[model samples]
Target: MGVAAPAASATPTDVAPDAVAAPPGDNLALTPPMGFNNWNSTHCRPEFNEEMVRGIADLFVESGLKDAGYEYVNLDDCWALPERDENGKLVPDPERFPSGLDALGDYIHSKGLKFGIYTSAGTKTCNPAGFPGALGHEVSDAQQFADWGVDYLKYDNCNNQGVDAVERYTAMRDALAATGRDIVYSICEWGQNQPWTWAQDVGHLWRTTGDITDTWDSVMSIFKRNVELAEYAGPGHWNDPDMLEVGNGGMTDTEYRSHFSLWAMMAAPLLIGSDLRVASEETFDILGNTEVIAVDQDPLGRQGTVVSSENGAWVLSKEMADGSRAVALFNESDTAQHVGTTAEAVGLPAADAYEMRDLWEHESYQTAGTISATVPAHGIEVFRVSPDGDWAQYPSAVEVGASAVQSEAGTTAELTTAVTNLGRTPAKSVSVDVAGPEGWTIEAGSATTSPALATDAALTTDWTVEIPPGTPGGSYDLTVTADYRSPRHQPRQDSLTVEAQVLVPPGEGTSYVSDLAFVREANGQGPVERDTNVGSVAAGDGTPITIEGTVFDKGLGTHAPSTVEIYTAGRCDVFSAQVGIDDAAGAGGGPPQRGSVTFEVWADGTRVAATGVLNGTAPAQPLTADVSGASFVELVVTDGGNGKNSDHADWADATVSCTA
Candidate 1:
């Protein structure tokens, strides 16, 4: 299924000066490739063996993933020995793949699945163990992969010895062609060189960003970077923003849904990066959404474009094959927000009404002209809208939003909620209700019902919420519901949920933050550590905290995009720490030490103090912030505008001082 070759180009550059200006004609990956890769969940771990791979293949068939358009089952790094054989051929790790690559490939083929292998364009792979790469051995390695029945190849860019990106990638493209096998070539250059401009005919898909961690910041950052490159993707090639971290435990189900929704909206590849054997039902439900998958695999292969974005609310639209528009309303803020767009704004033909199908909810609704939703924080709502489909009567589009409230234990606080009707028709008998957690009291302070709500009209209610005495300090949810009757007298309802923070002031004097249980914590790489250094990629593998030959006994060790929120209850006055990148990133290193991070302190959502970008080569710097009369203090670490390669950050001797 190769594309027709174009005339040879005269652009003189590196290795392939006469390289054709079209993709490798193998017509693979017409749409973004959907499959599984064993890297994010089990990276070079002992559990990533042949038995595990075989079990994944079985689960794909049993879990309906095979039927969901997932075709490739790929292996990442650490599947091979450190060195090649005397014949200069790559050798599979005997202990990991005792049956060898040929047998494993055959087993995968028998199950109606394709096999994929990985290699770097540099001299060695990215792992610290440094496995053999195919930089100078492209010919022999390509033949080896072809002989082993490989259907796909993910050529990575690590330790490339500063070779030209196009030259290095073009060598492998030509080498693969010489073997006479139709293999999908994936360019993993990490988007450092803007491969999208020239990779149209060189590879099937190109990574537009760095490696993705199972964190919200990582996901959002990658999405922002790749969303702007829609013009570079088409039928045969794609813009891959790395693999899917759907089943990973770092993010919530809502955030994971947003992750999947945005990726599908952008027409990115749907490669599963989590362990399927122990996956939860929610994970399977998110991955097996065929309606969403259809948009990704749509034959038109048009990537969605951002129509409008403001204040963390985004609206995107993708042109479908049947003259429909797949629209997404994404809310990136911490509170529920209303995101809206018109049919004409999405380039759809004018009509009396448009039929909208909720891709996530699998429900159908008719809209006069407005397509909108009250999207939850870090959540997404996707719809497939067409003007020529079965249209039903337009119903009331009620949206709900709430203001956040903070209260001390054993005290009462006021929360305000607003309900708005955005539809053309009016709603009758509209009533509101609020519910709190067990042992908490909720009372309505204003009128909770109205006879009729007209279009663009809003109703507000104030609720008195009480926190129980002696309740632990943390975050809790308040669920608000609105019930109304449509113009046709049909019962309709909508719900809004928001978080409330409760404060439990610490005792007067100084206390080490490591000794306190945080209200919430999130890390980019692994679980946040206490009194130790940010260790390897796995949890509980940390060593003693050491930075610039200095050791600390009490502190927090975490990765980039990390947050640790501690209760202060308007009593804390000072917070201090010695912050820097952990020395372990540079210790026992094969490649150059690579890590960059910035430290920040937030008091009641306000950044009080911060540090510039710090790498492993810099020494620890003292940090202090004034957090007086603040309910909580947030310690944050962010990736320093670069990739999160080795951003192991440490907050040593972290302490907070409180007044009596």
Candidate 2:
């Protein structure tokens, strides 16, 4: 099979030849289509049948995703039959899809959701076991999809070697329009030929990078890469950074939230590629974050950009429609970090008191100078800052901080107040006033403090408040007022509020397995890596496998042999890890331009799995073998594949399956 491999284009301009007919009527994706696609979770597996799609559609309705504006449920590669019918029209795989595509589409539409299908622009589809190709029959296939009630089309570029991308994609765009159906066209040419500059006329969104494997490197790389192309994305068309890998596992909740936040800021389509039927409540909530979703679907349609970034802490700011700004403080580093930037840096009107709403925590903060936070590792803090509309006539420096400590109901809860001056002027006498809810035992703290506050300095105090046992387990807000006077001026008054939540006692749960059973080989690249945190791991392995993304502590400087080793004291059946050339280290264009790595895996000095050459463009594979009787496993990656040419390999999500 001669697959038409494509390359990504970084050039700024597109070579648009001619324009095609506009899509029928406007119900199609005006903004990047918010939907779910099945590819990241289902790799054309046999178990992915129509019932699963219907069940996912049901979940879309039940989980409030449909109401939140996620409209399409798409199936990627392998849903098609091996060949077209006598009429040369694409057909669904009868064995896997007993109800056929028409019935499936009807079922999806019956639930108020749209249905989408996938095809390739080349001679043959990418599916190793699916339909032949849709190139020559673009017209017939488009008509056939419309006939079957298709609402969206994912046009891939597999097997389209030697063919011009603009010619191919534009032809399909015209064919879809000729069919008299309003289908949202999606171009998946792996960003070859700079689709961003040209895809506006052909598709609603176009993939701007290679297929996203679930990994922190992969996700963060795409995030950083796509945000730079903000000017290219717009209202009708968007820069598709591939589908989302959320809930597919291989990542902590923090990384996934960062992923979602980054994608939202970039104006990328929010396409869930996970099993919605089995999604956890946490996953459901992340996908249905209406505030974050609003940023992605903003009517202004302006993609976000990194306004400020340093030392793995990045701030992406997006301009919203209502003159507000969406800001995300992302900590890409493995350790927690304190990141901050001026409100003006994130596009807020200068020196004005703005109301900043924490989208994730659903809280509000009023600040005049800067937006700042101490973010967790692999976590993000997103906020929407809008002018309080009561624009400060005279800018002041002092800020009264109000915060609450959450505790179980019937227990003592803590309230905290701090005074901070972000402005130049400081107050000589600083005092705080506190108020509690009705009928609650409010043991307040000292109302005033003696310490004079200076610029950028802070003073804090705490109060112990007893929450009544009969009070409901929910959040309570305490009103706080601050009275302070500048040594050179008169007393001024401003008020702020702090919120605390009372929780219910948790129930006793069954014993669970702890991560203490896993041990590192002392040279693991970073920390314990979730399978999805490293690029080479399976898309949805769900099992966290340790990975080595770097060959050296400071990064790839010298080309040396890299290895990942792990051992199990108990009985283990299998050992596995996804292997590929790491993009993070190799993208730097260091020595050895072409990455070539050959890995030989051993168990107790016995060679069990020997892989061929691995590189970046090549699809990463899971290197696994039976080590049922072995006590130790060793994976040696050598540069001998192409004689030490940037052989930075990622033994992503390495782990062993214990028989115990």
TM-score (all chains, Cα) for each model? 0.87, 0.66
Candidate 1, 1-660: lDDT as tens digits: 001112122322322323425655567888889999999999999999999999988988998999999989999999999999999999999999999999999999999999999998888888878899898999999999999999999988888777788888899999999999888898998877777778878899999887887878789889999999887777788999999999978788999999999999999999999999989999999999999999999989999999999999999999999999999999987666879999999999998777788898887666667888888888999999889954647565677778887778899999998877755567788899989899999999998999888766778999999999998877888898999887764798888887887866678899999888677777777778999987755667899888777889989999887889898878889999999988887733323447889999999999999999888877889999999998889999998988677788999999999888
lDDT for model 1, please: 0.86
Runs in model 1 deviating more than 4 A are: 1-26, 81-95, 98-100, 127-132, 159-161, 334-336, 349-351, 393-395, 487-490, 514-524, 527-533, 536-545, 562-572, 585-620, 628-645
What are the Cα lDDT values of the candidates?
Answer: 0.86, 0.70
For model 2, give the 10-residue run with minimal summed lDDT. 510-519
| TM-score: model 2 vs. ground truth | 0.66
Candidate 2 wrongly placed segments (more than 4 Å): 1-27, 390-456, 460-660
Query: Which pairs of residues have clashing backbones in candidate 2?
Result: 4-161, 216-533, 250-532, 545-653
